[model samples]
Target: MNYFELDTPALLIDKEIMMDNLHSMQNYANQYNVQLRPHTKTHKMPKLARLQEELGSAGITVAKVGEAEVMANNGLKNIFIANEIVGKSKVERIRKLAETIDISFGIDNTYQVNQIEEVFEGAEKRAQVLVEIEVGEQRSGIIEENDFRTLLEAVKACKNVEFIGVFSHDGHSYKAQNIDECKELYLESVNRTLHFAKLAEEMGLKPKVVSIGSTPPFMLNFEIPNGVTEIRPGTYIFMDSSQANVIGTYDRCAATVLTTIISKPTKERVITDVGAKGITAQTRSIGHTATKGLGRIKEFDDVHIHGVFDEHAIIYNESFSNQVTIGDKVRIIPNHICPVCNLYEKAYLISEGEVVEEIAVDCRAKLQ
Candidate 1:
């Protein structure tokens, strides 16, 4: 079926563009001699995650245990939950998932280590975990060397836990002013993460995986150092408006919200069927990742969504209003593809204007 015939506010993935994105990231990882563990959080689709593995991805990364369960149920063996997991219930869920797959999660403190040790006790396999170093995002991670040492000491006491490696996210790299700044921040984060990895080594713990992530650095093709074993970029799999701005083009963006014009209220005001409920009200307001307005109207030149109601996107442009009538379908390049993906139940895969397949957003509401 032709994609144009689809209903309004439908999520669309250009199959060609999406495949190119997956291959490009895989190629970059290959060239740098690092394993590509593309984060499935961007698409939240088991089908896309499996495709990444088929295209030479070493494994898949997720933001939650529920997402990991969804992926594992669909046959993804190796999974990493890239967030500091807390709670006995969550740990139990991970333990059950561990029974079937090579699963792991992040830890920034000894308290988590103790919890993991308690949960995985007497189980057949040890709980695999990675220490998260706070590299500049100012988010959840161990910041001090002494604290990291203490955490490692706690891990040493855990008979059921295995310290596999350390990981860091250079999320602040998204705020880089230009290419030079982006590269500088990216390298600094990598170096800081490596510093902690080295500390773990000095204490007799050998880290098998030194993972670093953030889409800007990889999108700009920054060099990965020798010690870094893996890259866990999530947004690269489904490039959006903000990521496109980082590289100065939308040619790499594969996802869009397909909406139809529902009204022409005024000569300069047009309304789309989708609003914040569909494309979302997300925007990249600073640095190289900054994008214009709520979302970009792909069919118009420099025209953005002026505002959005709960169920309508407003476009206030005389030229845009004059160019189209009601019932005209258009595409919107969302600012943050992660949450935008979660807003939909299914995404239509299109190639050359034809709907090739319908992919379910398997982990759409798996937020726990």
Candidate 2:
């Protein structure tokens, strides 16, 4: 089927560009001598994760235990939940998942470690776990090395818990003013994570994995530091508008939202069949006015989505008004591809303007 005939507001993946993204990141990892574990939370499709594995990704990283279950059931063995998993039911589920496949998750506190120990005690396989260090993301991770050691001691006390390693995310890199700042954060984040790894080794604990993640730092044409064992980047697979701003190109944006212009209320005002529910309301803070919008319009550099309703994306551009008309099909490159991916159930794979395949968002809505 022709891509133009697909239903409006559908997710689209350019086969050529997607393949290029997959291979580019994989090759980058090879050059840097670090394991590439592309986060599956961006695309949430088992098929894409498999492609990453085929391209030499050591494993796949997910955001939730439920998402891990989806990938594990689909034959993805080496999995890392890059987030903390708590609760009795959830811990038991993680134990059950460990019974079959190699899985690990992140923890920053000792309470969470206690829960993990209780669930995995006397189990056949200990629950492999990683310590999440807060390297300026100000998110969910251990900020102090002393506190990290306390948590490490707790993990050691638990016979069922195994101290796999430490990981950190340079999410603050997204707000970097320029490549120089991004590089600074990249090195700082990795060095901070490596510090913890060295601390573990000094304390007689073998830190098997030292992971650092963030698309901007890894894709800003910079080199990964030595001793950084793994890198988990998700948005590189589907280059979003925000990533484009950091990486200095949109030609690599493989995923787009295919929507049709459904309304022309005024000469300067038009609406597409996609909205916050489709392309997401998220925008990037890249210190640029053009990128401060919701998403980008393909082939129309001046056209930008200014507003969005539940099912409509509003656009206001004089050039776009003069060129586009109602009923015309358009494509949108979203600002944040991760959440935008979870908004759709399936994506149409297009090669040379033809719909070649349809892949399910197998891990969609796995919020638990």
Candidate 3:
């Protein structure tokens, strides 16, 4: 069936463009000599996750234990919960999952280390963990070298927790003023992570994997430091308007929401059937030059979605009045692709404007 036959406000993925984005990211990882573990939280589809692994991803990265469980249940063997996993419930879940596959997670504090040790004690296997280092993102991580060393020491003391190495997000790279600044931030993050990894080795801990990446930094072609062993880049698989604007191109974005015009309230105003529920309410930061609206209409050049209601999108372009009419279908490039994927149950794989496949968002609402 054709894509138009599907209901409005449906998620549509351009198969060709998505394949290019995936291969391009894999090639970038190869150039840096780091294993690519594309984060699955972005797409949340097992098919895409497996495709990424088939295209040379060493493994898959997830933000939540529940997401890791979903992937594991779907036959993904190697999984890394990149975010810090705390709480007895989550720890126990991870311990149980370890029975079937290799499970690992991130830790930045001694509290987490102690908790993991207590939960996984006497299990047949130990949980591999990566120490999260805050290079510049200033997010959740061990920023100070002393604190990092302390966390490493705590992990070493844990009989059931195995130290894998260090990892970082470098999320601040998104705020880079230019491509050069993005490159600088990426390099700084890699260097700082490497410093901590070397520090771990000095303390008699073998830091095997040094991972780092974010969409902006990963797109800049920065050299991954010699000690960095893996890269976790999620958004590169389905570039959004925000990523494209930052990187100065839109050729890589493969996912979009297909909406149809349902209202023409005025000569200069139009409304599409998609709104916050369909495209997400996320907007690009003010620093981005292309920041204008919630999304852009792919079919109408220069047409932007001015605002979004619960179930309606407002488009206020006078030119749109001349080109678009009621019932006309338009593709919307979402402001942020990650949450948009979570908001949908499935995505229609479109090739040449036809629905080629309907892929389930198997990991959707797996919020644990």
Q: What is the C-alpha lDDT of each candidate?
A: 0.93, 0.89, 0.87
Q: Which portions of model 2 miss their true places by more than 4 Å?
A: 286-290
Per-residue lDDT tens digits for candidate 1, residues 31-148, read 9999999988899999999999999998999999999999999999999999999999999999999999999999998889999999999998999999999999989999999999
Which lDDT tens digits does candidate 2 get at residues 1-368?
89999988899999999999889888888988999999999999999999899989999999998999999999999999999888989989989998889999999999999988887878999889999999998899998878988988888788888998999998888888888878888888888888889999988897889998988876765887777899999999888888888767889999999999998888889888999999888876554212757899987875789999999999988779788888899999998889989988899999999999999999999999
TM-score of each: 0.99, 0.98, 0.97
Q: In candidate 3, what are the lDDT values of residues 1-368, reduced to their tens digit?
A: 88878888899999999999898889998997789999989999999999998899999999998898889989899999998887999999999999999888999999999999999889999989998898887789988888888888788788999998888988887777777777787788888888888899999997888888687777766667677888998998888988888877777889999898998988999999988988988886744424568998877677888998999999888888778779888889888899999999999999998889999999999999
Residue pairs with backbone overlap in model 3: none
Candidate 1: residue pairs that collide: none
Error of 3 at 254 (Å): 0.6
How well does candidate 2 match the true structure, expressed as C-alpha RMSD?
1.2
Residue 347 alpha-carbon offset, candidate 3, angstroms: 0.4
Ordering by lDDT: 1, 2, 3
Best by TM-score: 1
Error of 2 at 259 (Å): 0.7
What TM-score number comes out for model 1? 0.99
Preferred candidate (lDDT higher): 1 or 3: 1
Off by over 4 Å in 3: 288-290
